[model samples]
Target: MKRNVLLGIAAAALLVSAPSRATQLITEEEAKLPPPKGAVEVQQRGILRGPKVEFVSPGDAASSPLRLVLKFQSYGGAKVDPNSVKVIFLRTPNVDLTPRVKPFVQADGINMQDAELPPGEYTVRVDIKDSDGRPGTAVFTLKVAPK
Candidate 1:
């Protein structure tokens, strides 16, 4: 009986913390800036070339399982199919794409990826190119908090 009560309390705490953690990512001041044009706004890396990408959902944290959905704009203000927009994620901490992450695709209107990574400090490099062969690179860092 005591174990059941503790479990219920823990579950309730999780439910309350999840949404707040997500919302805490974006602030009103950052939203005031003009949105990126025809490129991936790699958070702190500034703007680089590629189909424009907007985070449908805010926040990109290093959790056990990371879910990300990116909406793309046509390259250079022209129509470019998502297929033509190649996107890959390279593990930056180590000079390889191996044992840590898997690449994903943007089939429809959005680029969605779900990556399950071990808990550690790491950086991921985003490599992208358009149909016309314009290339762009941006680096994103993830520090996984220990459980």
Candidate 2:
């Protein structure tokens, strides 16, 4: 009787400790998916001009100033609002950056001047967005030297 009780207890323990193999519930019919939305489109234009080095010193070493010139093409699409477009610059290493809004006078081009950068390698990222909220981005590397 003792052996039978021990065997029964072992069997009960095995049943209690057995791993559960549950299946994930799913409907027989396929799930309904939403239709795809229209994609956002953005374009960048123009050429950037600067020295091989990132820094420029026009006067005495102690008083020389640093300048960064950035240029790009304007959006050609009629749907894009030139006044609403904005350019953002992100500095690398130090991670200091700023944002500049393009003026409406020049709807087809961008020429920006930045003088607040310190000596280091900076990652310049340009973003253009249309009136409809579509956005495009371009990234470039700039190296600034000591004045």
Candidate 3:
């Protein structure tokens, strides 16, 4: 039917816009940056409820070109501000990853297929804010095993 055709076109468009074959999320140079001198402080206030972010797949360790999925849940009836999403490589002088994954970010979360990270362990920090201005952050380490 016409609906089916339209749906197919929509899917194709999405695929075209999605990030493909991500050889590396963080470049070797960026990864070599010195560790932060001190602990990074993050504080959230005012808002009675905040958003939550979680990795839905590819646990702590996975091979290259794996599916990277993140789930976001907003609280207090607030909706996620997709544009406020920030992805950072947690190294000294944090490297900004937001631009690299911006296209895949959505109000719900991020679903990146073929995320080909180099073989190593990486600490990443994801910061996001809800429509009400409440901020949320998640820090996790991903170990990409060698092929």
Candidate 4:
């Protein structure tokens, strides 16, 4: 009887599904927006030492449902402030993606297991501040082809 009960509990645990952390980073309509006018800035400067943002995964071009991994590295002993992270889609009006990705932001980096985006070219900008209030930024463009 004891062995049967243990096996049943294990089976039940296996059957229970865990909640998903998948986030829709960009909607279909948002992906279709026109490009930003003029030149968009792509640089980072800090007083002490700014955080370094790197697009660690999914390559420069990928299909939909991208596994986006952004790594943040701080220098001069300053830690990356999770709350100070901001994500932006550099479109005509500059769409704010910070709110959508805040839940996944951390001191070390932002990891989205499944970031859904439509098939289109995307220019993303990431801004962050260190514990000392030093600002940092990163800008990159990616192409999402149909899959």
Most lDDT-accurate candidate: 4
Q: TM-score winner between 3 and 4, please give it.
A: 4
Ordering by lDDT? 4, 3, 1, 2
**Model 2, range 1-147, lDDT digits (tens) per residue?**
999999999999999999643221111121122212332222335542211111122222221123334333333433434554444333212221323223211334343333433444434444554544555455554444565
Off by over 4 Å in 3: 1-20, 37-48
Which candidate, 1 or 2, would have the higher TM-score against the true structure?
A: 1
TM-score of each candidate? 0.43, 0.37, 0.75, 0.79
- The sequence of per-residue lDDT tens digits that candidate 4 reaches over residues 33-141 is 8888764546545453678898887886788788888999999889999999999999877899999999889999998878888888788999999999988888877
- Candidate 3 on 24-79: residue-level lDDT in tens? 56676876777665545344446447798887778868988777789999997899
Best-matching candidate per TM-score? 4
Q: Which consecutive 10 residues in model 3 have the weakest lDDT in total? A: 39-48
List candidate 4 segments past 4 Å from native.
1-21, 39-48
Separately for all candidates shown, the number of backbone clashes (residues 3 or more apart, or on different chains) is: 0, 3, 0, 0
Q: What is the TM-score ranking, best to worst? A: 4, 3, 1, 2
Model 1: colliding residue pairs: none
lDDT of 4: 0.85
Point out the higher-scoring one by lDDT: 2 or 3.
3
Find the number of clashing residue pairs for candidate 4: 0
